[model samples]
Target: MTERILKPGSTLGVLGGGQLGMMFTEAARRMGYGVAVWDPDADAPAHRIATHSFIAPFSDVNVRDRFARIADAVTLEWENVPAELCEWLERGCPMRPSGAVLRVIQDRIEQKQFLSSRHLSVPAFSIVESALQLRSAVDRLGLPAVCKTARSGYDGKGQWVLRDASDVKQVEHILRTANAGRRWILEQFVEYVRELSVLVVRGGNGAQCVYPVVENRHERGILRETLVPASIPLDVAETATEISKQVVTALQGVGVFCVELFQTTNGSLLINEIAPRPHNSGHYTLNVCTVSQFEQQVRATCGLPLGETRLLSPAVMVNLIGEEVQAVTSGEGLYALHATAGAVLHLYGKRIMRPGRKMGHVTFTASQVETATETARQFIARIRRSS
Candidate 1:
């Protein structure tokens, strides 16, 4: 049976309207598709540009019906958007990644278990439903482990690093005071050589395209920068790409998915976590790739042929978090940023700024990876000093 293709001018529905959704909307519009953005937050950046905007809660049946009626297909910007909502939306329009996939990936424990059950390499982990269970899990995993909420946490929130007994006690108290039945996962802390990520786009027909593995650096659990064509051996990059493709294929996922991996000192790769949508690490794709990840998301969601993933140039992507955006908004910092060659700036158009919030990003592209890396490093350092 031939799959239906949503031709250009078709309205594509997107759940969650953050920066990723905003970028997706932009891409879809550029490709001659109209986007319907459904996010409860009216201030969501995507809503500002969407052809149709729904500010109602996901549970509202009226909004759901209307959105389903207008959209030819649907995709998500964030994993945390209720899986039930995706299931409901699936009845009227195709969900790029079915709700079942979202249910498994949205929870930390389930995601890890699913990958491990599939014979994939993942960090050692144990589930914790209570303080006592947490203690036991820590004992089994040993000290210097990490504990994170099983659901609904990102950008370093709802996570704790247990370097000692005191840190464990602090987390235990927080768990004890929390509502009942809350679950968390304790993972063995890995001594990794570097963090890496790859973006895979799978069409509804099961055709897949894998992007180059990129190196990522995080500060306080937030992604700070990404280096394209990760500074790793060819074999390691191939292995990482293979593992990422294996993961999305196992889940039967359609759309753009980013697989984060840990390259251990032993030269083995361990699955860190997966993002159902385009990832921050892949932001470099916009500047250097033949087809940006956002465009791939649009094509995959509409059942169109997946775009080429060829890299046009070596690049580096640096995120502007919170007040760091002020550096590029005006003054000598702004002039300096614009003065630099091969630097592209992208601001998320977020009106409010708070600590730890992602505000914008800068992608530096150059003929050589070393040039891009150095330019990005100097830019980052200048922003930090100004901030």
Candidate 2:
């Protein structure tokens, strides 16, 4: 296939019209490009911003062709979109990161295998195909292990942690009720010092750029905060950058990739997972980096030059979840954070609200990450008080 560079007026097609798609469309539109999005929801956030919105199922042939017909290149904000649909679009227009990349990344088992094939470090994992396999994997991996669905699980959904032998019954019940007749992976839980993520973008020409490492904090398996230029040893950050580049290179596709890593107490890094799109942790880049991760995604997919990822300041990002959204709507102190200096708020126009659902995020820049984090904490405390 010949490489083609898309000009400013070219149309970009996006799959999955969620907040990520909305942000990607915003970036593309800002750079004089047009965006067409295909998603089932008519009220999706991206629909309000995209140049064209196909409100139909991903498998609908007409909707798929309409997207491909108008797009010079197609990319996705989420990995769970049907791989067959992506492959079909590939025949009509270029698909960034490729359908093959989606197939490998959409499944936890395949992702781990790919990492292992590249000699990358990952936790011990076993695939469970049946009740017998689940029990055996739990017994082998021991207590405090996590049982996760092999596919379609995110933000702690479709996951159960087993801390003791007695938890086995609860795990079995969850498996039967929540994931009946589906494949799962049992992984040995890592007692990590901190969680880190590297956002790397690789272009069609094999050129790549790495964003500064960000340390993440999760509440109940959902990302809550991210601190850029993670307060780790310089050598450790360098190592993570190199590892993230290797993962993107191995993917053999063009687009932004988010590699989540676990920093163990022994100071070693292990691959936790990979997302082939602009990630939640990379949200700080929109405020503190020379170029946002969403813009980098558009640049890489369109065969444009990868943007600078130099951090403009020490930054912290706080996720405004559904619970916080409720508080803010009720005239709680959560809305008072809008007055915070050096803070930038981005609210996704999502109507539905539920516990743990991501509604938006706020980023704060400061001379030091500690100061930025403290300011974010104050806002979080205010929101918590209302809850």
Most TM-score-accurate candidate: 1
**Could you tell me how far off, in angstroms, the CA of residue 271 lies in candidate 1 after the best superposition?**
0.2
Off by over 4 Å in 1: none
**Which tens-of-lDDT digit does each residue in 119-194 have in candidate 2?**
9999999998776778999878887898898999799988888888777777776666654668989999999999
lDDT of 1 at 34: 98
| Every model's TM-score | 0.99, 0.96
Error of 2 at 3 (Å): 3.3
Candidate with top lDDT is: 1
Off by over 4 Å in 2: 177-181, 326-335
Worst 10 residues of 2 by lDDT: 326-335
Instruction: Count backbone overlaps in model 1.
Output: 0
Candidate 1 residue lDDT tens string, 1-387: 557899998999999899999999999999999999999999999999999999999889999989999999999999998899899889888998889999999999999999999999999999999998989999899989999999999989999999999999999999999898899999999999999999999988889999999999999999999999899999999999999999999999989999999999999999999999999999888889889999999998888888999999999999999999999989999899999999999999999999999999999999999999999999989988989
C-alpha lDDT score of every prediction, in listed order: 0.94, 0.89
